[model samples]
Target: MSDPDLLAKLFQGDPRSIARSITKVESGSEGAAELMKAVFPRTGNAIVIGITGAPGAGKSSLVDKLALYYKDQGEKVGIVCIDPSSPFSGGAILGDRIRMATLGMDKNVFIRSMATRGNLGGLSRATVDAVSILDAAGFDKVIVETVGVGQDEVEIVKTADVSVVVLVPGMGDDIQAIKAGIMEIGDVFVINKADREGVIRTQKELEALLGLAHRPDMWMPPIVRTVATESKGIEDLSAAITSYFDFQKAETGALKFWSDALGLENVHTEIVEDQKVRVAMLPIGESRIELLEPTSEDSPISKFLEKRGGGIHHIAVEVDDITASLAKLKSQGMRLIDEEPRIGAEGCLVAFVHPAATNGVLLELVQTND
Candidate 1:
């Protein structure tokens, strides 16, 4: 079938077509990028839940129960389980056979098992695309169960709408969770197998650790206890998930509303790879506000965030010639972060004037391609 026809079928919630589309992206088949480009706009309709933890944390069991709960509520559920790869075939060693026994039989529930495919983070490179396919295919809740590779699974934060860190009592899982740096990313923490011993102790430790965490949003992550085998606390888990999801939507809406009230028209967004920052341009009259979001932890913007939270990083002035401007500044005894013009977002040649030289304000000189 042609791409458009397949996409139409996929959008119609045709299970076979959805599987086919995911397979194409998973294999890096030709036209995969084009297919994803088409599928992108149809996404953001599904709430993507990423579940991760150490091995034997009962993550799969929790996922199965959670998915069934969503399915029972009349919402289409898509379950993507990342399993260890088979050495020779590079395919999921534990393919959907196990989950197929439970959820695969239901028309409203779609289950897919993806191989980690050598990604140490326990996620396949194409896993995000597979989730996007399911999202576009009209799944109301897409649950991504990772390979449970502990700390390495931090990549889950990037793709998931809400990140869930699953733990068990008496396994020292709380200590492991802290070591894995999972505490910071978890929007909702789950204590699965709550019937086990040391439940109270584990919860206390988790609470103490959470108390020490200082999120920029100042939102406290809720802890939900679950006994997945007996399906106890499933509703509570769902409620916690919903609460966080709704809170994020409200926060985002407030920001957009504030920007609208300020009359800042969003121009465009661009990634400056050299500095590892994503720039969002919003023009206000003659001046524009450039919001810099760090793409990596070691990036300069991230350091600024750690030290000063959120505020203006720099002010930029467009010039006719950026290189000449930098040279002139340097000759006049001005300290320059970039002695020569380097590429900034949107192909603009840019150079930075050090804060010391600019009266404690970092300044950028830009020469736009336009």
Candidate 2:
């Protein structure tokens, strides 16, 4: 079948299609990159919960119980368990589907077991690809259960939206966690096997350790106790997850631009008559959004305002010399919107190439003054 048909089936929650697509992506198949590109925009919707702890921390049990909790809430759940690869076979050692026998059988749940494949942080790029596929497949919650407190596991957990660290009583896991830098990454802490002898002691120690570190987000990680075997405290765990999600949504702070993604150049708020126009300098090569509310109905950006309200007005590329670039384009018999450069927001010298010349994409070339 073609990719579009396969993609449609995957989106329709066809178990076979999702399993096949995931396998192809995991195996580094020829067209997997294109599939992932189509899947990306559909992601960022599912709540990605990463569970990590030392080996034998009962992470699998906790994941099984927590997934069941989400499933009970009428949510479509996706579970990806990253197991250690055998040095000889390079396959996942513990098949998570076996442990999660009941969940694996549920039509609303999709469970996948992936081998770390000797990749760094125990999370291969394929694992990320699989998670994206599940997210696109309309899973409400995607749980990633990874073993060990190694640097690779920590790195894997860091990619999650909510990182959950599991601990057991009397394991001396506190010291190991600090050593592995797990203290900084955990958004929620769980002391699984809570019915054990030293449950309170472990909780106290975790609280004490948390007191020492100050998070920039200022979110005080909640410590939850769970007895996964008895399905105890699973409700509390689910509640903690919901609470964190609510907190993040209520948080309105400075917009953060990641160093690897985009940079911020300026922030200016303007009032054009009654409506407000906010100019945020995204500084991603040279693309920008312009919002306008003109006194007259015949404003320049009125067409865009009429279409889909408003969004990115044009795509801009940074050029060393706008005049020279435009001259080069004109020599090639290309159509231009403005032959001369003009001043834009934040004093950017810019010129626009007609969308007709750029295959229906408004292309603007810019030269930074400062």
Candidate 3:
């Protein structure tokens, strides 16, 4: 990884390099943090999907099918399966090589299984870092599949852009706690094993429960029924996910996760117009979030919504010297979307790096007068 060429290979979507990067992160190698920081600018393009549910609820099966569905659409998929740790071995017993045999055959699909290894918190970050590696390596979709319906699983799922809570028919009132907790997190409700006897009953129960629960985002969680073995309802499930992704663009709830994680709160909010479209600005730290929800449907973010629904708005990094940095970048022959600095949110001078320069990620460089 110290070799510049070897490190560069991972950015080119080399599978071996990607695998080695994940291994380093999983093992907490010394260079792992630096590597992640370097790749951060290239991330935020891929869709993160979290699949979680109780054991035997067919969570993995649903993930497998949904991933396959995405692959069928010619998208590269990445899967990180969190398996229970074995006290004796301390390794993933059901490794990716063994469990996802079919997905393994596809060069475009990268699957890794991680053992809980008694470090639930560490495992969550490691799993997230692994997904970032795949995303930087050009994966279009990264799905994190975790077992059980506990707090640890909930924490891991919180890192996802969209989360799916898997369930099966006949769990009944015995799973009330799960419903209460998981229902609060799930963006999509999945009823797998739809061929079961109590399929309709489960759907009715989910609908009734959803009616009782309210989300601040106002995005209605869709119930999708699927028989994973037969790959039934996968298209419907995919559609449901895409629909939700679109619905969240106008809301600030999506950025709330990261803002809260960073222990930062929105200090001031104001509306700014760009090209006849109104966008919201919520300032944090020395940077501010330029929200993409547009007042008009003709702006760039609006077109982005029509095409890809809601995706990453942009990654803005602060720089001490914007002009000098841009000059150096130009001399280095990097493609820049904004050739000169302009006033962005909070009156910060900013410029953008073209996606061609950063692995399909839109990046903004911000500089403050201070």
- Prediction 1 TM-score vs. true: 0.68
List, residue by residue over 244-300, the lDDT tens digit for candidate 3.
776775365645764767655555543334333334555665666655555556777
lDDT for each residue of candidate 1 in 1-370, tens digit (9 for 90 to 100): 9888999999998988988988888778899999999999999899999998766677878888898888889999998877444222135534466566776576688888775555543245578888999999999999988745554456754479899988889866446546456777889999999999989998988888889865655469999999999999999999999999998785455347548688676578667889987777787778877777776799999999899977778999999988788878988999999988888889889989999998999899989896
Per-candidate clash tally? 0, 1, 0
If both were scored by lDDT, which would come out higher, candidate 1 or candidate 3? 1
State the lDDT of candidate 2 residue by residue for 35-144, as single tens digits: 99888988888998998876667777788788888888899988888754322113453354465465657668888888555555324577778888999999999998
Give the runs in model 3 whose Cα sits over 4 Å from its true position: 1-3, 84-94, 252-370
Pairs with steric clashes in candidate 2: 121-152
Query: Which model, 2 or 3, shows the larger lDDT?
Result: 3
The deviation in Å at residue 33 for candidate 1 is 0.7
- State TM-scores per candidate: 0.68, 0.66, 0.68
TM-score computed on alpha carbons, candidate 3: 0.68
| Per-candidate alpha-carbon RMSD to the true structure | 11.1, 12.9, 13.9
